[model samples]
Target: MTYYRTYENKEDVVIQFLKTRTDRLLKQFDEGNYQNRYEWYKEIFEEILEQKEITYKILKTPQLCAVALEHFNNFAKVLLPRVYKIEGDSTAMHNRIIYQTGGFVFLMSHWVLDGCRQSPEEMAHLLDGYIHNQ
Candidate 1:
């Protein structure tokens, strides 16, 4: 099934999708009502399946969870340098590094609101250049 585009390209659609879903997941995780990370991810992935206009064939819940986790994990790894750069110039917040996964979650919340405006692949490339050792 073809998912119609409101954005310029498939990349744009994916970027928007990631921003939206990540924002929701971040919020739910922050609320602390969920028992564990997998449970939280399960709920968010179910919501994505229900609400998003996805073109991929349906899969089992575990499969959906796997996909979501992989995407978010890649995003976190690629974006880590940017987060470190932001924090490096400041002295106000250090927790972002202490718990890297949580830091990524918080950063993703800002991404949805602030808008990265770059595609994920672009961000990953920029990250590689910025970090050098990655």
Candidate 2:
């Protein structure tokens, strides 16, 4: 029941898209902490995108890419298993990202989304369907 959402990148900087909702997602960014390591996270997302160029195959097939894009909710998980949830599964989170490029779009959730809490992989799968078929 993840209350998923999707939006076009509409910009070159990935952070802009991510920042689109930092206010609601992050507890500190509003306090100005995001600025401290903003560049780092942005670079990380960009680097992962570049290293996984093979994934771009989805872009060509918008049908498939659209399916995978649904997993966008896992964006929070991108930095999950973070300092707070250090004991959880990070690799699991990694498997959740929905890779896209340009003014690319992805998904996200309203805290707790659909009442039924979701795993990173589950989120990815939902998007995968759209990415592969749509």
Candidate 3:
């Protein structure tokens, strides 16, 4: 049996939303054609962004765009393969990746929210390198 969490903080709420949303998108990717999966992934990503009150337009600013792009791409590449290795089936692997992705997103979001003041490019390089090296 699974126990659902009730989130009181904005960070927790956003992370929880991403956790569930990513799981659904991963399932869509598993079932969809290549093109369709990309589309579905975009739609679901947009939905989660809205739920988190995060604006793509805002994230695209020169200071932040690199971080957004790098983390988004690298997280999928690094995390998905690891989860896939651990869980054979598409569904099970995706379920695990959901939590893993959410945790990373949550930590990064907290860094941003806490006014870390690092440029997105710097953050991306630091984070992507860390994840890749690990």
Candidate 4:
């Protein structure tokens, strides 16, 4: 709290924290080279699982859930195109990205809420299956 004294409210603090965390993950994703998108997803899932407590708290909180979803949306927008060939009508592409991102977040939220019963590798494989089938 003291470190974030500049923020006027809790929402602001959460937003800033999410932005920073998302930025770091994006940077790592961008810098790393992987044989496939699954590898990238696995790495990210591992990182998130390491912080499951905090993530669960954020997802459970109504206001913070919105913030988390927004950041996840932004993160997906930047990361997805790099791994997939996303080309089409502008509106259609945007909607596709939103759905894809939302689905991924939904899976993650449920996984965290359910105590992350699946390992990160398993989660990545599941997500890969979804993406591959699409």
Instruction: Point to the candidate with the largest lDDT.
Output: 4
Per-residue lDDT for 23 in model 1?
A: 69
The whole-model C-alpha lDDT of candidate 3 against the native structure comes to: 0.51
Candidate 1 residue spans exceeding 4 A from truth: 1-6, 51-74, 78-134
Top-TM-score candidate index: 4
TM-score of each: 0.36, 0.27, 0.33, 0.86
Q: Residue 89 lDDT in model 1? A: 31
Ranking by lDDT: 4, 3, 1, 2
Candidate 3 residue lDDT tens string, 63-132? 4444454445545754477434564447765655665566556555664455545545455555455545
Residues 10-57, candidate 1: write the lDDT tens digits: 455555676786667666655766764445544643554354335232
Stretches of candidate 4 off by over 4 Å are: 85-89
lDDT score, residue 125, model 3?
55
lDDT score of residue 71 within candidate 2: 35
Q: Could you tell me which 10 consecutive residues in candidate 3 have the lowest summed lDDT?
A: 51-60
What Cα-based lDDT does every candidate model obtain?
0.48, 0.40, 0.51, 0.82
- Residue-pair clash count for candidate 1: 0
lDDT of 2 at 53: 43
* Native-referenced Cα lDDT, model 2: 0.40
Cα-lDDT of candidate 4: 0.82
How many clashes show up per model?
Answer: 0, 13, 0, 0
Worst 10-residue lDDT window, candidate 4: 80-89
